[model samples]
Target: MKGGILLLRSIAVISSSVATIISTMLPLFLYVSTPNIELISIFILLIFSAFLIHGVLTHALNDYTDHLSGTDTNSPAILSGGSRVIQTEVFSVESLGRFGKWLSILLVMILLVFLMLGYYRLAVLLFVGLWAAVAYSVPPLRFSYRPFIGEWLCTFPSVLFLGFAGAWLALGSPPEWALQNAVINALICIAWVMVHHIPDLDADKNAVPPKRTSVVWAAEKFGLAWSRLPALTYYFLAFTCTAWLIPERFWAGAGVTIVTAVSALFIFKMNVADPVQVSSYEKIMLMLAILNAVWLGIFI
Candidate 1:
């Protein structure tokens, strides 16, 4: 049971989520954006905790539903599949399901408290987040399995909701610069999901009924190599626009993007035949660079 609980925690991928909220919050922290912004407060920390709880809820529920639907068992990929605890029998699926449900209830209760505090917009966004987190995997609206449509539906919430929730709470109404940055970051977030799906294309296609995710759809329509083109193209557009947004850090950002492109090329060579489980590495590099570049461009 103890081991099971530990494995459950490991799969939350909390650190990545933390990176997201942190980078999103970075814009709010800048002196030029929120002049004389209150540096620290109990409320800010409470909001931060809420974001983490929300992250945990998303991961836990996603794993539970995927396990129940047999998707996790059908065709597992290293980076994108639910944690294998259920498949391995490390924990009963029932127990995992209960864990996710309780987490959901806890998050809803927190949002209600925020509502009572009269942060209407913040609460509403968080509620949308709660819905997206659950519905991403649940039936009647299992967005994750919806192929091309699912990609935007699933990625938009995590980035937009979590990102804006932090920004709105911090700035009340974001200025033009902050708003543009949020939208750009959200686009990058959406593109990042494509990066994730790239490595999972073959695995997802081999599923029981073949889950045709965006990457799978692209691979089917245009071939796997062509599927890679859209994502690479999106990154260039993102970084080019980002360069304009923060010209001082333009080259720094481009440098990171260049390194990621090079890394992608090398990874391509490493697993040319199978497409293996290698695209996940490039995704990680791109994400880290985005997070790091935010700091370099905004804070540094």
Candidate 2:
């Protein structure tokens, strides 16, 4: 039980669950017109399970990397120090590596089964998603160490692509409505990634190769200015996408948009007043994610 708890903490279970939920549900909500409720629920569960397993593998591998790199010392609460198992000596490095490798292989096999069931697009998408996960911290790419590329790759391929691919798999092909939702989803996803970095501002400064965005932004006023432009652009694109593609659900879409915009505004305002008070920003991100998923379900 103790070991199990360590594993769960290492994997950041709650965040991983939310990631799976967004990846699995957005696509279904957008593309599956007249969806069979029962079938959709099953697919969601399956996808969520797949993502959870992937997250576990990723967490293990990442922890191994951080241990090797000596970057896990004195990390922030939200920065995933990757020290849980390593610091506790619950698992040796060799054992953790073996676990990660086997877990990744198992995830691939499961994804292949989903593909054989006629979900061809999902199979292709899963490959890219897994690649991004590995590339984020692994050699030959280590893209996550880069600045802008890290942020966008983390946000787009992993989040946006998976969400879109899931929808395509469930619905065969996205309707204009689903496509519109995809745009909004992508924008929101980008924003979420940006805000997630705020919590890691300090640790990221000492990254070996040095992340450009983090360095530049940290020098600014509370890191708020760095994301302001992107955040505003995301909100604008979200509203425009919804307005153009979902005119029928205008009132609902507008309401959600307004709320999201306000939440963003509050985060910015609070950040400007006190950079230390960023818990509200995190809450706003969670709320936006939930509301975005709910709106897509209701409107699409």
TM-score of each: 0.76, 0.75
The count of backbone overlaps in candidate 1 is 0
Collision pairs in model 2? 27-167
Model 1 — TM-score against the truth? 0.76
Supply candidate 2's per-residue lDDT for 225.
54
* Best-matching candidate per TM-score: 1
Model 1 stretches astray by more than 4 angstroms: 1-16, 27-39, 42-54, 74-76, 243-280, 283-287, 290-293, 296-300
State candidate 2's TM-score: 0.75
* lDDT by residue (tens digit), candidate 2, 1-300: 564456555223333334434544654545555466854675665466444544566567767766665455445544345537877788887888787778778869978897889767667666766776677767656665665565466545565554454456555664555555555666665555555555555555565644334323544544545545445455566666655744676755775577567757765575632334654565666666656755665565
What is residue 206's positional error in candidate 2, in angstroms? 1.0
lDDT of model 1, residue 206: 70
Worst 10 residues of 2 by lDDT: 10-19
lDDT (CA) per prediction = 0.58, 0.58
Q: Output candidate 1 Cα RMSD.
A: 4.0
Residue-level lDDT of model 1, residues 4-104, one tens digit each, is 44444432233234444555566556553454345245236535554454445665676676666556676435555665677777668888788878877
